[model samples]
Target: MELRHIRYFLAVAREGNFTRAAARIGIGQPPLSQQIRDLENEIGTALFHRVPHGAELTEAGMAFLEVVAQFPDLAERAIRAAQRAGRGEVGSIRVGFTASAAFSPSVPRVFRDFRRSYPGVEMTLEEANSAQLVAGLRDERLDAVFLRQDTIAGDGIRLHVISSEPMVLVLPSGHPAAQREKVALSELRDEALILTPRAVGPTHYDKVVTACRDAGFEPQMGQIAPQLGSVINFVAAELGFSLVPKPMTQLQAKGVAYREIEGEVPIAQLSLAYRSNDISIALRNFVSRTLVAHRQPRIDE
Candidate 1:
């Protein structure tokens, strides 16, 4: 009736003697014989034919033995399944990232390497602004996020720096500065600046502002874009020059040109954020693996 009954029945069938079966199972012979009789009564059929020194199987006994023989293997597989799940080996994780962050090495590189180790985990990536990504993590709608930010808000979210790269200038292709391989931060002092608003990513926006200040002049503020990719589009439209992560250069815009800065380059932190209270085994496994893989190193300007 129970798994133990099935196991005991199989053992007795295999050993052919009550004493031998009980010894194999670490039980007493008398209890084993009584248990077998109890099992037969429950099934409403005799399972064994008692002989001179041992037991033989009845027609019903042979059929039942075959069925019970599979129970051990099945039980083992069930246990193994639970163990694997407990270890967070198989499940789904919903991840969030900024449009530009996807093109960066942090997301694609870390995930590409993570999948190799945890192929059973299904990863779903969504593109959102820093604000939206933060909201998703707070609401528990997203399992994790990769974004560039100066300071992250909310006590419910945890942030980690995955990669660091110096900020560069994205200028209109027709701009005179575009012809220069390197431009000075102070050179942009007189030019209008385009940037993602503080609401979208206060920390990242501040990083640029702080760098410009340290260079001896506050950048002249111009248009405000809601996201980094739009910051690039604004530059391509000749709206204004903008500071961006070096990795942002990978985003192809023929109308735009990327130039390194001559002064102290502000380092952009490519960061990962997730709900502090997230208890998903899949999400936890992903965070654990990624942290082990990505140790931030400051990139040169």
Candidate 2:
């Protein structure tokens, strides 16, 4: 009826003598014998044939013993699995990211470290804009995400800043300003600028606009792109110029050239965002170690 009953029955059946079985199980002979009697009564079948010296199994007893013999192995395996899960070595995690994050080394490096450390855990990656990633975190659809700090607003999430890099002006390689090491924001005042879609993250779009305004003039807004990769592609084709995170230089765009912006505005911050309630040990270690290993060194311009 219970695990103990199964264990007791197996022990008595194996030893074939009530006194010996009780001794092996570290219990008194009378109690062990009474327990066997109770078990038989519950099953409505006699499990042993009484004899003067010892006992022999009934047909039903032999059948039950064969099935119960497999229990020890099954129980051991179940306990091992539970232990691994508790230690965060075996589980599934869903991660979301912006398109630009893929271009950076932080995401890939962290994932590689996580896989090596916890080979039993499975990771799923989803690509979305910062706004969508934030929504996914709130709805419990994503375990964590790498996104721009400006876009994060809600208080229910915790953020760990991984790196910060200055915004670069991306221009066509053949453009006149491309030859320069740095470009002033005022130089692009009259030039058409490709803008990231407002739906991508309102806060991020506003920051860009504010930066341009602080430069003494409003930008000539051109076409809006859905994601960073597309915006970079457009810049490569000389469709328009755009300001992007400096790490984006890692992504080689054939006709695109990047330059540091000449101003005192704060650089973009990249952070790992997750729900405050999430307590995944694997996720915590992955985020922390990856940032430490591949973080960008500070550069003074």
* Per-model TM values vs. the true structure: 0.85, 0.84
For 14-58, candidate 2 gives per-residue lDDT tens digits of 888888888998999898888888889999999999888878899
Report lDDT per candidate: 0.84, 0.80
Pick by TM-score: which candidate is best? 1
Clashing pairs in 2: none
Worst ten in a row by lDDT for model 2: 292-301
Local distance difference test, candidate 1: 0.84
lDDT of 1 by residue, 1-301 (tens): 7887887888888989888999999999898888888899999999999998989999999998776778899999999988888988888888898876887766787788778877888888899888888888888788899888745765777787877878888889998878989998887788888988788787788888998899899889999988888999988889899988888899879799999999688888888888877788878778877776675332211
Model 1 TM-score?
A: 0.85
**How close is each model in CA RMSD to the real structure?**
4.3, 4.8
Top lDDT model = 1
